[model samples]
Target chain A: MKNLALSLLALLTLAALLLGVAGCAKEAKEEKRSESKTATETPPVKKETIILATTTSTKDTGLLDVLIPAFEKETGIKVKTVAVGTGEAIKMGERGEADVLLVHAKKTEEKFMAGGYGETRRAVMHNDFVLVGPSSDPAGVKGLKSANEAFQKIADSASNFASRNDESGTHKKEFGIWEALIIKPEGGWYIKTGSGMAATLRVANEKQAYTLTDRGTWLVQKPNLQLELMVEKDKPLSNPYSVITLNPAKFENSRVKFEAGKRFADWIVSADAQKMINDFGKDKYPEPLFTGDSTLTTSK
Target chain B: MDLIYLGFKQAFIMIFKGDRLVFEIALRSLIVSGTAVAISMIIGISLGLTIALARFPGRRVLLSLVNTGMGLPPTAVGLFVALLLARRGLFGFAELLYTKQAMIVAQTVIATPIVAGLTVAAVQNLNPKLRLQSLALGATRAQMLWTLIKEAKLPMLAAVMAGFGGVISEVGAVMMVGGNVTGDTQVLTTAVVEYVGKGNFPVAIALSLILLTLIFLVNFVLTQVQQRETSSWPKRISK
Candidate 1:
């Protein structure tokens, strides 16, 4: 009876191992089926999957969520977006991994274009950065016409200011403002948080300190934060986002995805999508926050 | 492909340069997994040995529950722990989420069951006659228990080693709980993920190579120790 029991247990263990192998095989078969279906359906027309590297602001702003679905519905081209910092996004494009990039760093984007890695950097949307701090405005530098002047006062007062130092588009803009104010913000009060926009804002909120944030992210986070807009409409505060497709002439693989990238880009600059961006922050906040370019609609 | 060669070259250069970031990541991974293994072994071995040696009415049910936990996914454990530790969750006041301590806790939860389950199986696999013989030799109950523990040491060591390996390779649990904060919580596996996401194939490849090497060394050392213990225990038991 003991021998029989041992034999049965051995057989059961062997059967379990076989079942595990079968499960793996089943998953592989399903993957193949999906791949073949896509290939066969687009026999005549080339169906390409484009990798779009864009900023988190675009996603946090709900711009890409609205625009990507519409673009996919209209063109039947699938766009897989990898949301990252503009620095990381540009690096992806440089590595020939991303077919197109929708980023906001003008200087960096221009360098990429000049380096021959990208082509046709088109301006897609514009939102200004704002100085947000505790509603108490501890520095008492609110209503400043110049963004630099507000920054100067904050520095002079040794008030706490959170800076995103992750080489992100927002970080770049923050540094530019600090440079224009001619102040090297290196003291204890000037917190150089090498983190994402969301995290930096969270830090600012926690410390009840000052921070510069894009209008979209700020609008989304406004309900939760005790911070208020301290400065806006300054020329230095203008944050223009752009979209650039990889230079297909250099990378042949990106050429196949060019059509998909162009379709997504076209949808971003479209009137309907622009309207959505314009009306994104109206309900709870009551401020439009961003103005869509009406000139594109008029030109069309 | 050309991409493969480029990735390989970049990985090679990064390793040769002794990149501070890569070293820091590797060190964190080791520390996290080591702490997890240490905690799990203590809890698993004590509970497993007690259950193995004891006779209780609900012992079978308790064993079944541990077996169920053995198959729990890292992500599920991570999410459960996250919910418990998140600001809105049960222990929200503790503010443990997104901290190294939280990662260690999640890993411990994941690995303890694996160690315990394996340990129970290991202890049970021992010959019943050995314990009977020890008792017949005028040994006290405590002495007999120590003999059984000594006999099962090899399997327990092997079980602990295997559990350590499982925790170290995991990314999801660590990422969710630790937040993969650069210079703070960024581990080797999560760094690989971030690099891959950024399309930085070279850094990803280099990290992966290092991960592979580390896993191989751990497995090699563990297998050797396990083999030595298993071989020597049987001889000692027979004598």
Candidate 2:
């Protein structure tokens, strides 16, 4: 009888522990749901928190460090920046998990806006994508004027090309170039990283292959990489970053900080923020990482 | 080589200087993985004990399933959990995706099979006569089972170690479900990956060293616990 009691106690203890964890998880989920509901109903209650989903390049290049702090100081709103690929950032926006999105994938952004995921979209900055490869220039397309021509030469020579196959902005641009050239690049020579720009750059550097990368990330990673800017000055290689505010009405269940997101969007294209973006990376490199141009704005 | 040395130095500095971010990330990693191992231990040990002692139809198939689960890839588990917890997924109503709880769930899924498989092996390794002897002593079924578990405690500790090791070192599943959100879901391994992605090799190396040291320290403690009976040299001499 005593042994039965002890065993029962042990089983109960285990059960209790499991229940405790499950209870906590359920409570947390409930708390979040309730908070989001409240946030939607009382949008003017003015929550101090704003969630910004953005591309890894912005984070890798330390642009968010400067821009976020400046915006936070100006508005007294804390920004929680989630740095991911542009594709993931846009997905977060579509899901209403983020209040704002700062991304570089124009095509994806247009689709997002057309789907009514974004309330406002404004171009904040621009940076060109450069085709980087080992100084060996195995494809021998260093002086190529067009990205498509360079890609063709790489395909013709069957030189190694590392692709960030994560549907990121740079990856999409690369895909565009390939599509324009009508080349379905698939071979052992084409390596798919399925990672961020910097990681893909490292893979390209290690493999001594060519890759498409934003000038910002490239400039930041230049000192460490063995690769050089093999192709640039292409019309199709222009990379522009835009700040998008998630439409609160479209996602009534989400705790979207519509007011704070709008403030951030306006501040990003404001004169001071534009100047800050324009001046970024001047000290360490020959040119700034991004050109702040408020002239380029896209809407649905 | 120099980078390795620099990594150690940086790790020590980060530890000693009480770097808030590093400390937070390490603490979060411990809490997340530790809780996962604990939960897996409960389920795995119970299931393993049942499988080892109980006689039932399809037991062989169940054991085979557990064995297969032992080799399940972390990324596959991560993807499964991600799909389940995604906003459009079945349990999307819970709003658990990208949260620490989601990370725990993914790690638990990855660790449970390891714990269960090792546990089954450990329990099976015990002398079958031990169960008979315990029952002969007029002990009840529950008491006999308890005695068998006590005899198998050391190997069970090994199960604990393996489970902890499996989840602590895992990066893929956690990265997918947890979203690697800085100051939130960023554990040591994911943080190492992030640093490596940014080409900050020194920081990445430092974080990797910290992870290794953490795993070593945890296993060392478990080893001490597992060998506690044999550790008493003076008691052995007196005997």
Best by the DockQ measure:
2
Model 1 lDDT tens row, A45-160: 34454667888677655566567766555555656666678888898788665668988888898899888887567777788888899877878888888888898889988999
Residue B25 alpha-carbon offset, candidate 1, angstroms: 27
Give fnat for candidate 1: 0.00
State the lDDT of candidate 1 residue by residue for B146-207, as single tens digits.
Answer: 88888776667667767877888898898777766554567788888666543457888998
Candidate 1 stretches with Cα past 4 Å from truth are A1-45, A252-256, A281-284, A294-300, B1-239
Mark the regions of model 2 whose C-alpha exceeds 4 Å error after superposition: A1-51, A65-82, A95-99, A143-145, A186-188, A248-264, A270-276, A282-286, A295-300, B1-18, B56-58, B218-239
Clashing pairs in 1: none
User: What tens-digit string does per-residue lDDT give for candidate 2 at B1-239?
Assistant: 66567766886787778777776677677778877988999999999998999999999999999999998899999999989987667887776777889999999998898889988998898768888888999999999988888877766766777787888899989988887776668889999988776666767776777789877865765566556645654773684
Q: Which ten residues in a row have the lowest lDDT in candidate 2 chain A?
A: A1-10
Q: What tens digits encode model 2's per-residue C-alpha lDDT throughout A7-76? A: 5334534654665576468657864665565555544335466678899999888788788877765565
TM-score of chain A of 2: 0.84
